[model samples]
Target: MTWLVTGGAGYIGAHVVRALAAAGIDPVVIDDLSSGHASFVPEGVPFVEGTILDQALVEDTLRTHGVEGVIHVAGFKYAGVSVQRPLHTYEQNVEGTRVVLAAMAAAGVTNIVFSSSAAVYGTPDVPLVTEDLPKRPASPYGESKLIGEWMLRDQGVATAGSSQPLRHTSLRYFNVVGSSDTSIYDSSPHNLFPLVFEALLAGNTPKIFGDDYDTPDGTNVRDYVHVGDIAAAHVVAAQRLAAGEQVEPAYNLGSQNGLSVREIMDAMARVTGIAFEPEISPRRPGDPDRIVATGELAARDLDWANRFSVDDMVRSGWEARRAAG
Candidate 1:
């Protein structure tokens, strides 16, 4: 009856575990502690430290834990860096997913809630990206994620006649920020909130990648959802899948009402009381001017929404960052 959460010691995965715990559901964790902290796994929660690439270990963990479902969140998740390390990214995200799926099949665990990304849209033209948008992943990381979704879909097709055809859903999100748990902080060098917080904490000027983009502000505009909300949606999806209820193949957990980079800087100044302006830097290659998705479908199903405002998002991450310091 327990749910196995892969990468449950990582920031977002830890939040998902907390959400599942709050729902009175038992969560067993399988984390390799690659970028995750062992301490983040809740005290007394069943934890097995191993990579998803180990199919035997994954299968054993599922069988040993009597897991009814899995929330797969373990993978290499740096889109920008993936361009430079395509092979590593593919091995971790694609191959790791393959191993997890194989283990699930072997263990007869037929339900899974995948931790997906909006990077699959890859410079989408639509102002409001949706579940129906054609996936055109730009980087290897995004490509790997799309392939993971395909794996789930094809598996569902292949096992349709089985007693337990895999019931699964992938939640695609962009720019997850803020923190509900001060103990679990975002340490990703590639993420915006941590990058800015680190720069300010070091008494260095935070630099904006570009300020010449064609947006309301001079910088890019994208959906920045709170981590807590993201975790909540995952729990909801898992519950639905485990209940054998029909769910969409994929859902995008994003904000129709997103913020611009400049607007975020303004919030940072207000929240952290840091008055210095961010340094302007050259645009990173393949940087889009704006990329925000509408979560109407997720809202209908997963209780998704932008419950936290820009100020709330900024303050939450700032508080966690300061606490970590």
Candidate 2:
């Protein structure tokens, strides 16, 4: 009853892998080492160095390892960069999901936990978004993720008549930050935390894009959830699917309360005891003013609760970044 964790060497993926291992479940991993670190993967787990687009490799890994479930987390996730390279984003996120689904169908692995994003909800009229909100993705990355969720839903329907029907759960997360351990600090230069950390390390002020939004602090507000909580939700989602729980295809993993950019910086300063300055800049395209999730559905269905506060998230990220240095 092994699980196949795509991009298991990545920041959040590594945390999921660690969570699975801590629960005494040794899942097989397939990561290309594109933006993931090889050291992030634990020693005993069997790791395959490849991409999810490699259908043959994915099928082989699934079949050989007796993988009953899959947690897909391999994809490009930079909003600004996605706008510049829409085609690359589509290929990696949308087309890559197609390959993984095809392989799962071939290997008879029906259970899946998709890593979706809250970016799919672009500039919602409501303050706290629900699962039923209209998906109006602003960037190519968000569009690709929405398409990926559609793919899973379609696949699940197509396999319904089979003896072992496909069961899928897509967790739409918002602003996934922080670290579960110091060993797997974020390596991507695109995410906000790592970018700010790098800037501060270089003795420069972290830049804040858009200081005049409609929010209270005149900055964008986001629901920042800890990586460990997100990883725990994945585990619970997998268990529910495996237990034959008749649930929807997707759930939102987010903090019910939102945090503004200024709040985040304040938390960072408080956690690290460093007075950091921020350079104000104009808003980047495709960034919504406020995007937070209710996460009530996930709590009711998957029993997912975010235990780490915003301060905890910032402190853990600071600790991990400091250790990495």
List the candidates' TM-scores in order: 0.98, 0.96
Give a tens-digit lDDT track for model 1, residues 1-325: 5999999999899999999999988999999999999988989899999999999999999999899999999999999899999999999999999999999999999999999999999999878898899899999999999999999999999999998798999999999999998888898988999999998888999888999998877899999999999999999999888777879999999899778999988898889998978899999988888899999989999998788988999898888878876
What C-alpha lDDT values do all the predictions have? 0.92, 0.88
Q: Specify the highest-lDDT model's number.
A: 1
Report the CA-based lDDT of candidate 2 relative to the real structure. 0.88
lDDT by residue (1-325, candidate 2, tens digit) is: 6899999989999999988877666788999998898899999899999988899999999999999899999999887799999999998999999999999989989899999998888778888899999999888988999999999999888888988688998999877899989887987787788888888788888889989999999999989899999998888888888888877778888788889999998887777777977789989876778888988989988778889887899889888989987
- On the 0 to 100 scale, the lDDT of residue 144 in model 1 is 96
The candidate 2 region of ten consecutive residues with least summed lDDT is 19-28
Candidate 2, residue 203: Cα displacement in angstroms equals 0.7
Error of 2 at 246 (Å): 2.2
Ten-residue stretch with the least lDDT total in model 1: 316-325
